[model samples]
Target chain A: MRDTYQEQLDELASGLADMCDDVARAMARATTALLEADLQLAEQVISEDIKIDDVRAAAEHRAFGLLALQAPVATDLRVVVAAIHGAGDIERMGDLALHVAQAARRRHPQTVLPDEVKSYFAEMGRVGVELAEKAGRVIRTRDLDAANELEADDDAVDDIHQHMFTVLMDRNWTHGVSAAVDVALLARFYERYADHAVAVARRIVYVVTGQMPGPLAV
Target chain B: MRDTYQEQLDELASGLADMCDDVARAMARATTALLEADLQLAEQVISEDIKIDDVRAAAEHRAFGLLALQAPVATDLRVVVAAIHGAGDIERMGDLALHVAQAARRRHPQTVLPDEVKSYFAEMGRVGVELAEKAGRVIRTRDLDAANELEADDDAVDDIHQHMFTVLMDRNWTHGVSAAVDVALLARFYERYADHAVAVARRIVYVVTGQMPGPLAV
Candidate 1:
């Protein structure tokens, strides 16, 4: 039977995985809100971000209690510390999704993306959700191979982000500067969301392997 | 006489302060690089960012060691935990500065900012530096009043960020879509730099008072 200390550690891991799932759902809905110009869905994402924050606060409190009470060492210590950092990254992922939703609401009744770039955003959204869900799986299973996969998934998001700039800068582009600015910021939101998911995956790798794969590209 | 554990805690606090100063310097130089179109200065900021990262790594190592060896509780545990979080926030501030520098480098031989918005960016740089310096002070001194001041300073950056969008969308904007995108992203880098500075301050407040001042506005 697992001791209470081990149980608490297991709970922390599951809690972080659950937070990743929450943000994944948030990103999926946020993407729909962006693509469909669905004001109601956007508002739902904007309001529900607090639930992610609540999970983060609870994870931090639980980690703190474990650290103070158990004084966990070695891998256990790394797990608790990684939980604290992972919670922060996942919370930021939620914030990035919220930003995407807010961008959608800001342009409601007037789609933020031009017809030309909608497909690009749709692809980014799909990849972003995949990244978030994979990050959760990485955290739950401690599968280093899965954690490493997030880097490639993040590269896919970065490629889309780069392609977006090319579209914005093309001479054939017809969207005004305002729309261009909105698209640029929105692309960034997606990119950062993927980056945070990758960050969470990296933290889990550290917890299991005692080594960070590498510094994030920044 | 202070035991080695107490000395380690003090060293961790001062190390975080030093990191805040490092990022502050990076931001100031990055702003100069942005405003003057100094390719050399921009390159300098980009390369020197690793030094900030080094400090962050060291701080994290020290904190982890303290947590494992000392098993601190209550305020000491909070202090060590806050140092880890603070280090991350300050390192992100450094990354934001590097992004600003990269923006400048990307537009080398051509100033990134048009004349109309130069003054606004200059002001942001100035205020951003002030916020970083104040955050360092807050970490070192645990001054709650000083920590509260960061919110107003961040507001100043936000106001400038909002105003820059208005300028970009103005009927008079003649810089075209590319320039508008550059300026939008630059403004966000500055605004986020200020936000991280505030995040560091809030973490310091939590260390001292055992209460987070509030959630940072996403």
Candidate 2:
């Protein structure tokens, strides 16, 4: 019985790691779709997001089920609670990626951005995909060092986000209203996608350290 | 002992209701500050948001304590878990309100928006504060009807959000890039503020109806 409980706990952790992988791949593909104007790839990312959600839902079900059936307490209980919340953070990251994919799909054959903004988004996509991959490793290993490193990566994303505004707010900006709106929303989706990654890392830190951290910047 | 547990649970519920009130008031003041360029009011809202955070933190601590000490199960267990998550949703709403206040402060004596965009934000503020109040009542009463009604109120916010884009995208739009960015971010703060209220209401619906609902639109 004890072995079964431990196995279930391990399964929950592995499930979250897998969800992180899905979200990372989705983000990378969504970025590629956006930059390359690949409608088929954009659609693929959108559809794959559903699988991410299903994985998250299954993880949460398992976490809650363990709580109910195993009646875990103390450390075990905290692990379950953290898994549930962390799964939510991961799920939200997946949704953010989906938003990126949808943004790409909305433009279809048309490019989503002017030349000036495209490069920033391309960089954001690269950084976001890299962070998602790191998040997967941190969750799987509970590496405190990696968890802390996630924030620095997030700062890089924030810098890109701020640079996006600098370009938009520049006196030379000639993109007009429609392009402006797209840039604003798309920048936000990527920034928020990175924020959720940091948030997931924070939750894992809490689970491992048993220190309830402040809420992630939303 | 059971009565004691019940009383603690009641206290948790009341704590969340009070947070709803704080968040609602902060949002109202933030809106006033934004429209009138009231730096003092904006500062007040920003400072008071700390109290809101304190309340939510306490509530989570108590709920976790109940879980550990009471060893609650079944419906009782669900209530505690829901309260923890619900408190988080409300706390995030508070953060959104704080973001609104911060935006107003960031602009200082100068208004954050051009005169053209002011009325739309004014309307969004009114709807947001009213929904926060309604959300309080829904959480306190667990009124499924009111909980469901919150979605309609959120639609009003969404409409305002869409209108913001329409204004931004209009050929006649005269607001420069800086003002446009402010409007975009402010509109989103209000829109997301309403989304969190709906998310909270959904949590209450789940607690009351014992049927897990779909995730709120992120």
| Deviating ranges (above 4 Å) for candidate 2 | A1-3, A213-215, B1-3
| Candidate closest to the true structure, highest TM-score | 1
DockQ of each: 0.86, 0.53
Q: lDDT (CA) for every model shown?
A: 0.93, 0.84
Off by over 4 Å in 1: A1-3, B1-3
Number of clashing pairs, model 2?
A: 0
Tens-place lDDT digits, model 1, residues B47-73: 999999889989999999999999999
Model 2 agreement with the true structure over B1-218: per-residue lDDT tens digits: 34598899888887887888889999999999999989999999889888887898798789878877787777677777777777777888888888888988988878898998788889999999988888888878989999888899899999989898888878788877778778888899899889888878887888787776776557
List TM-scores for all candidates, in order: 0.98, 0.94
